[model samples]
Target: MLPFSGNASPLPRNAGVALILALAAIVTASGLLLWLQARALHRGTSAYAALETEHLRVAAAETARAALYVLAADPDLSVDHPGEDWAQPLERDWPGGIHAWARVEDAAAYVDLNNLACSNQPGRPFSAILRNAFTACGHFEADAPVDALADYVDADTTGDYEAAFYRHADAPLLPPDRELWAPAELLHVHGFSPALFAPPAPAPDARHHRDELFGGDFRQATVLLPDAPDAPVPVNLNTATREALLAVAGIEHAATVRSAMSLRALHPFQSTTLLAAASPDLASTLEGAIDVKSAYYRVRATAEHDGRRRSILAYARRDPDGTVHLLQWLEGVS
Candidate 1:
């Protein structure tokens, strides 16, 4: 009481404790606000990235379409040969670290699987050709695969697998009995495996390279469906591989097929007349089976942006009136 000073008492213990608690609450609120802001920013960035990736994909697809239009407008649409503008790969670099590329392939050069079974006949010539082609590709029991596929698409009840066969299976599935919408649908057929139809591994030596040089490799042959189910699909002589020619003409006509390959290499056939003049025997044999032009083309487009990638596969069908239409489009390849 004698030491009373002008200054008031320092403070109550409870008051000091309350002040400390208030400071702690303010620190916690600041930290939580900062965390919420960071989360919002992260989500916004992610959404923008996804949008950019999709835009890049669409741009790549349009580039491929424009290239196809250019090809359709060419006056020499009668023949699809190497070194043509359409045959060359298209590549483009855009702003913001984006890149795109595309390539065109002749769909008519490949054997049409739809042509084989659409007739509803199991033992058609196309089926035999498919069997032979698969055999040459190193598949064992090739006939089983061909027969199973024929049964899958043929309308007739007479097939390798009948209704009774599917009834006892675990999945209890029946044949589609219709044209195949896509080549990959073959995997659903019995005796057809991915390993058998996959692209062949690269050759290890010069001898293997030489063997593949003349299209002896079965993997070079593509499996495509015809654009028009009712019309007969013809092979493009200008683009058909030697293996395809052999499959169509039979092994007995090997010499004539080799001759045709040589002639086409020198000068791609401009028309069926040119092909006939080059190899009369083979031409006459493949009259209705071959053509010098391709109405169907496959286009593959790929795009890359900001460490993201997208790709699409499209089929372009050119009409007789010179109008090109997109037959199919498959996206998100890789």
Candidate 2:
């Protein structure tokens, strides 16, 4: 016989086990809900961070462009290009509580791609410089190939310069190289070497400061030789090589001419001497045929964004009074 209690009952072992299982299930469900909520929050936070970084990058680019506009518009600014001592952060002004600064790079501060001093032949003296420019830009050529660009653009050429560009095996329908608007494109050319293109390393007692070098674009080795109005340097018809004469602006030849020796015999011509001494027929042919001056000049600008920094490349021309005009801009450089 067992005594029965009024307020108590004997529980089955199975019923007690059932109660414990129910409690365990609730605890696991609660934990899973919390984990899911935390994951959602982390994803939202990551997305917001990415969006903020992009906005900051765009702001940085705009800041650079605005500073460039200021440099171009200021009348009091000096005519000196970026490489000169005058180009500095003080040249620009920032607005709207935005912290901004800039560095002007002289395009001429580096080796000029247009300089035709390749084998030292007047016709092709710029080969080495071109090669160097290409080397500095290793990826450009393998991706986009242009074989004989310099030869095609100069004053005299036998045919269309673009014909020489080779097409990639992947896309033979398209030309390997594209048209170039700036000397920086040299880095995009094929067979260029980095060792040759990089500026000579800084010397222990370097007269030029690092700021000066970083602030400019690379320049071409060849500059327009001064020429008189009527007699400009006669790009030799018989002696000039095809590469040297191709980009001469106005010279037209029927076929590739070998003029290495002939060009050496001919002295550098100013318009005054060249026009008078050249055959009348030849002189008449080249009246507006040559560009006695070079159109390219280097430019640079810098800006700060999100506590980070960036640089830009610009090619430009300036009037005698320090007013600058844009030729090109390298955007979003870090």
Candidate 3:
């Protein structure tokens, strides 16, 4: 085994070990460099996402303001219908490839929920409208949500669907006992579910369409006029759907509603007198509850860039003089 004679062997045994160590060091350094590059890329993406959110927010806000201005520019505020210019949706293409869209809907086209809160009595005229809506939709015990919402909105604790009913669930809950901050808060009340508020699926037939009018499209048939519990928003005769019109008045004579719809389709009703001439009985029933114009409008605005999007829901009041005042602004609406 001592074939090597001099102090130096053919080669040092440590040389092989040194080579392995050098290769390992190089590999480790390469791995570290790759990791740093990946981390930098991740940070960059995050930063870009944040910036995009800000840009979208600004664009969405701009869209909302532009929509309100469009509403303000309407030449005639005496009457508003879907055919009006302001009722048309607005869209714009910004310089930076960002796109925005906005639209306004007659808020009075639906039953106003805050009106129920204002009365807190289910059988009153306004509450009856909500009840009739549920009935039209074929909801059993049509008064259930009406009463439940009463408990949720009233300050007093003396209601059948009040706070106590929510306490025994797997997760106990308590109502705020105040006006709702938003329509979505209805989910927190007893006897209300997410399914109830979801958009109605399209129906293929006439019979199914009638049933979906209020029952399945409950969310579309009702609204919560922001911070307006005491002042009632009248149903716009020029814009209210047949279901909504029947809710305010009664469907005992659906023929009456059909006649009104038929007449309005031919030409928009200019005043309550026109409705009175059509049917004195219907006019009487809808007296203070109806208007040829809408004061409240719901505005939705959205912006998108690079497949990312942002949105806002705006509630506003339009005065007869074409003035627009924003009542509420909700961000993060899809």
TM-scores, one per candidate: 0.83, 0.43, 0.85
Tens digits of per-residue lDDT, candidate 1, 150-245, equal 777777878657565667777888787777778677777788667766666667776656343332565565466535455556678778877677
- lDDT string for model 2 (138-234, tens) is 3224222223445433334332334344345232332223223443444434433444345545545667543321221122222222111122222
Scored against the true structure, residue 92 in model 1 reaches a CA lDDT of 80
Q: Mind giving the per-residue lDDT tens digits that candidate 3 earns over 6-74?
A: 876654567767988999999999999999999999999999888888889889999889988988998
Over 4 Å off in model 2, which ranges? 1-28, 74-86, 90-98, 108-178, 181-190, 193-333
Q: Superposing all C-alpha atoms, what RMSD in Å does each candidate have to the true structure? A: 4.5, 12.7, 3.7
Global local distance difference test of model 3 = 0.78
Give me the candidate number with maximum lDDT.
3
**Lowest summed-lDDT stretch of 10 residues in model 1?**
210-219
Measured with C-alpha atoms, the lDDT of residue 160 in candidate 3 is 86
Model 1 misplacement above 4 A: 1-24, 93-97, 120-124, 201-218, 226-228, 271-285
What 10-residue stretch in candidate 2 is worst by lDDT? 221-230
